[model samples]
Target chain A: MTNSIRAEWTKFRTVRGWVIGLLTAIPLTVLIGLLGPLGSSFDCAGPNGAQCRGNTPPIGPDGTPVFDTFYFVHRTLTGDGSVTARVGALRDAEPWAKAGLLLKEGTTSGSRYAAVLLTGGHGVRMQYDFTEDIAGPSPDEDRQWLRLTREGTTLTGETSSDGRRWSTVGTVRLDFGERVELGMFVSSPQHLETSNTFGGRLDRGAPTVATTSFDQVRTTGAAAEDWRGTAVGIDPAREHEVGFTDDGGDLTITGTGDIAPIPASAGSLGKTAENALVGAFAGLVAVLVVAALFATSEYRRGIIRTSFTANPRRGQLLAAKAVVVGGLSFVVGAVSSALALPLVERAELAEGFFQHPTTWLTELRLVLGTGLLFAVAAVLAVALGMFLRRGALTVTAVVVGVVLPYLLAVASVLPTGPAEVLVTVTPAAAFAIQQSVEEYPQVAASYTPADGYFPLSPTGGLVVLCGYAAVAVVLAAIATRRRDA
Target chain B: MSALHAEWTKAWTVPGTAWLLAGVVTLTPLLGVLAASSMAEGGDPARTSLLGVTLGQAAVVGLAVATVSGEYGTGMIRTTLTAVPRRLAVLRAKAFLVCMLTVAGGTAAVGASVAAGDALLPEGLSIAQGPVLRAAVGSVLYLALVGLLGVGVAALVRDAATAVGLVLGLLFLTPIVASLVSDPDWRERLLEWSPMTAGLAVQATVDLGSQPIGPWQGLGVLAAWASAALLAGAAALRLRDAS
Candidate 1:
């Protein structure tokens, strides 16, 4: 088996076109990655038409980009304090709109915070930081009493239908300074609407504001300063009006913008690390072509008969060929991906595009998974070539089955749901291996494949592609043994 | 004239040619049903109904590539060149035949896809409308042009798998890479020149102003690609020795 494999490798290396083709994939991947960021500029329009530079979103406690804009009505609390308010009504609210009491270390964007809020659609939720959410007792939308308390470093959230009986929703530990802001807040994220069109999708976002009326507001262990309204992280360019009116404790707040993890959706300025690897698809096409020709050319030249006679074991010969092609492709994918990641990220960063943070472990998976993706796809192509023995048909079947689905799904052509279904089911599922970001359920963002969010987990997607490759290899082996080479 | 006649006979003699032509017809509407059913009630009905052309074009490309590359694979090209020494005439004949067959299959496929769209979509299709009529006719022209492009590529490469791969990479990869560009100017420039994106713009019955290129101009871009490829193949055929 080793000898056969060595012989196959020698044959592959000897072919000038095959060697050149495999080499071509590396440069193609890197070139696309490097050039993808070119000609794209980021210039934010500051208030009064001034150019805003270095306006990247604030980083959360976990180092993720977060949406930290909301209307805060608060007063300083000395220590071990609690705030309670009855959310009387929520008007013109988007589904994910929030209205309730919050306790935070400061009024700064992305500061540590905890809240028990009544959502426009979901009844009540206890959320902390930017990524954590716990459901409250009721699913009711209006007239709910919400409370938050702090004892030393421990924070607790409770909800009540009336002012009399209460239920503890959830609890967590968060250390704050000697004084903290405790008050009522309101936020409504941008409203998103997707319309399906021929050959593409149209994603439209309009700014939406939520008005929440709070009454019977009470504070404990607080300073004597009067309540103040601050528009934390609000963008004046978006024409978001965030303010509050305190009519003798009958407070009303109207705000546009959310306090949650940033989503990879339409109308978002945040990009993922894998955005720089868009050129990987181009390299994949080049590699698959070379792999297809590697097997079909042997049959086209009648060299397979000589190979079968020399080996005497057709299955072993098939395995040897698979090893040679798959191994070469794996190296090509891994090396190119590793080289492309840093260069593309640097270029995009220079252009003022802030990439969502990713750990080194996730980056490592991305690089290796790309290599495995190329390896398995090459094996699948080689197997299909052997089984069909028609070069044109085999190339078409694999390319059409793999690349076309990805194009349709990620090119903004299909709607989000159907596009998600396409990536999940097709061999294109393997593209998920390139995703370097995670989706947070607490954030109501468009989780489409086009937005760098895939339906399947990275490992699961690779497994699906491997499943296809394995089936093709087994079938090819059976055909090779049964047929007269 | 004899070259045209001889090429037609050679093409029809192969059973694969008939099956591939049938694939163009069947696969076109089969995907149209899936695509049209997935669409929500807003965009151009004519364009949505004709989405099957994207997949069906693969069959057209396959049939076209086989017409030229199949002969080279079997060493039959030398025999044909001996019988008719004019190589350019042989290529022209093959290109003409591929276009004719693709146009016939494309028309049938587009008709069935439109019917499927009418049945599946909320906004029914009517061919009597100006844009709808243009989309139907332009789609058939688009398929023919793609077939011409495939034949030219196959002649230049002289290998079926490599040629199909190159042509498909050109057809499908451009728009995908283009969409990833964050710069709207570059994205529009890439789409304006892309064969598939530009050619398919002819199908848009609504939102014409928003398209990067107009219908006639987009088809012209594809025609430019097809002609350039054909001319390059002619040059290669004249320069290279026949194996």
Candidate 2:
């Protein structure tokens, strides 16, 4: 065993490709890590605030709010506009609502009002235009109301009666990194000398017949945590207005500002470590592929007979190859992880490092854990290669084993419930270990607290990933021991 | 003609080549269809349809690596050398065979993907658009070029696994590293030059203005990498002993 280990180490050091492959991981990890934070900076403020400044408002040049930035509201109508009442009459009345104009008795022109509320630069708003007249006497009759709210790029709209019970109207998305706004205005078509009335009777002796109320307007920042047990409201617009109520410890909202960047977070560090392990495992596939070719190359060249003459023990030869390949992979994984750590740490610190000691421990565990995964992969690869004895078959099988499950996970042909579980069980499950987010939608169903939905627990996801690795290793080992070299 | 026939027989007789070709055929289109379907369900067709190409290129690289590495692994290069004696001919013949196979396989994969995308895409995605067509066709060519890179790496490394690793690392690692890097300028430059990133530039349909490298130019960059690898491999093959 010692002789094989020493021999393997010698071979590994001699191999130019292994050296290059191992060294390559350092720059690669650093590069990908840095890009995540550098892409864009988020401003939690909208157009009319100090955060915006000379910076282009999250809206377009035409003053339309960009979809992802904030909820925009313009109470005033643009172009040719007139407010036609549905269930109410317009009257020249004294001001009733704060931050808006009022219509009084005998008012000829429509009342116009516009207000833009940027949800502290987080979340979206739904737009509501109450001007579209409802033709029927029924209160449930369809009417145009503009309401907008955003989560990521997704925007939802809703309408309400008395600002409480809301009905969903529609949803849409604008572009990323753009501001959004809502506009409201009321206008009458009648000449200035003539008075137009909607709703109740208009008399000079009494107050005007029509009145409209807009209240309970609110927006809350969408939680950045994974959607699990959170109620996802159908009304995309009013969803922002819905607040969180704690349930079991299962569903929690760790706001964006509170959560550390990926490298700094304990969870994120674990994830990166897992990623390194997976990468090392991937590299082990390469080692196995090469080793199989090396072993078989001798056979195909009729040199195996000579090799056996020199060293009669077939197991010893296999052992030497396995040790060499596995050792190389271990060194490669460790060196790569070690080299990558400082760079990733520096980048994370640039973003703001987590001060907790637990975070550092998680990061350390992640790096060591990744090294183990690579070693395992190397051993599995060599064993498979030795068992198969045919270079082409071994390489094909190894490649398929490594790559196929990942492909299956991403392909959504399976039924949603089963597919979600299956996807989480495959490479996606393994990869999910790299995520800092407590709940990942790719692995499980997510819900908002205001909306009702159940998702798999994070522990469940980890078990599934471990299951895949165990199954793969066992299969490879079985195939290795049973097959002739 | 006999040499071509012999080479053809040699290439096909090996189970690895057949399996790899089959993988290229089935996996690429299947991935494309799946991606398209997923995207269509989510209301974004283009990103979904082209997803197969992301993974398919890796397979193409694998296939290309196997072309040269298989012969080296089994010690068949010496037999071919004895038959043809001219080292350059063997290299040329292998390159030609692999390129033709890759192009044909890549075309099938890309075509199936595009067809699947067209069938599965939501109402808004139109296959008739010129730029979209270019992206689709360019994707096929990109796979072919990646295959060439694989072959070159195989020749240089002379070990199937090492060659595959080196090529995959070259193709995949740079982009990953570039992504991890904190500096935008370095990342942008890496994205422009990284073989996989540059090759994948052909897939950009939506925001042409924002891409680090232009579509055609990205393809050209990959071609350069392939050419350089092949040249280096050919040189190595010329200087090295058959064993």
Question: Which candidate wins on lDDT?
Answer: 1
Model 1, position B217, has a per-residue lDDT of: 99
Q: Which regions of candidate 2 deviate over 4 angstroms? A: A1-339, A347-358, A386-423, A432-484, B1-5, B40-47, B124-129, B182-184
TM-score of 1: 0.94
Off by over 4 Å in 1: A42-47, A52-55, A89-92, A139-142, A162-165, A236-241, A266-268
lDDT by residue for model 1 (A1-485), tens: 99999999999999999899888988888888777677566457766766545367877888887889888999989878888889965655787898888988798898989999988877789999898999876545468888899999989999888888989999998887788888989899889886655566677788788997999999888886789988888876554467888899899998878989887653245667777677787788888888988888888889998998898998888899899999999999999898888888888778777678888998888889899999999999999989888888888888998899888888877777778888998899998998887788777767788888899999899888998999999999999989977
lDDT of 2 by residue, A278-309 (tens): 24434444554555555455555676566556
- For every candidate in turn, the CA RMSD to the true structure comes to 2.4, 16.7
Docking level of model 2: incorrect
Best by TM-score: 1
Every prediction's TM-score for the first chain?
A: 0.93, 0.42
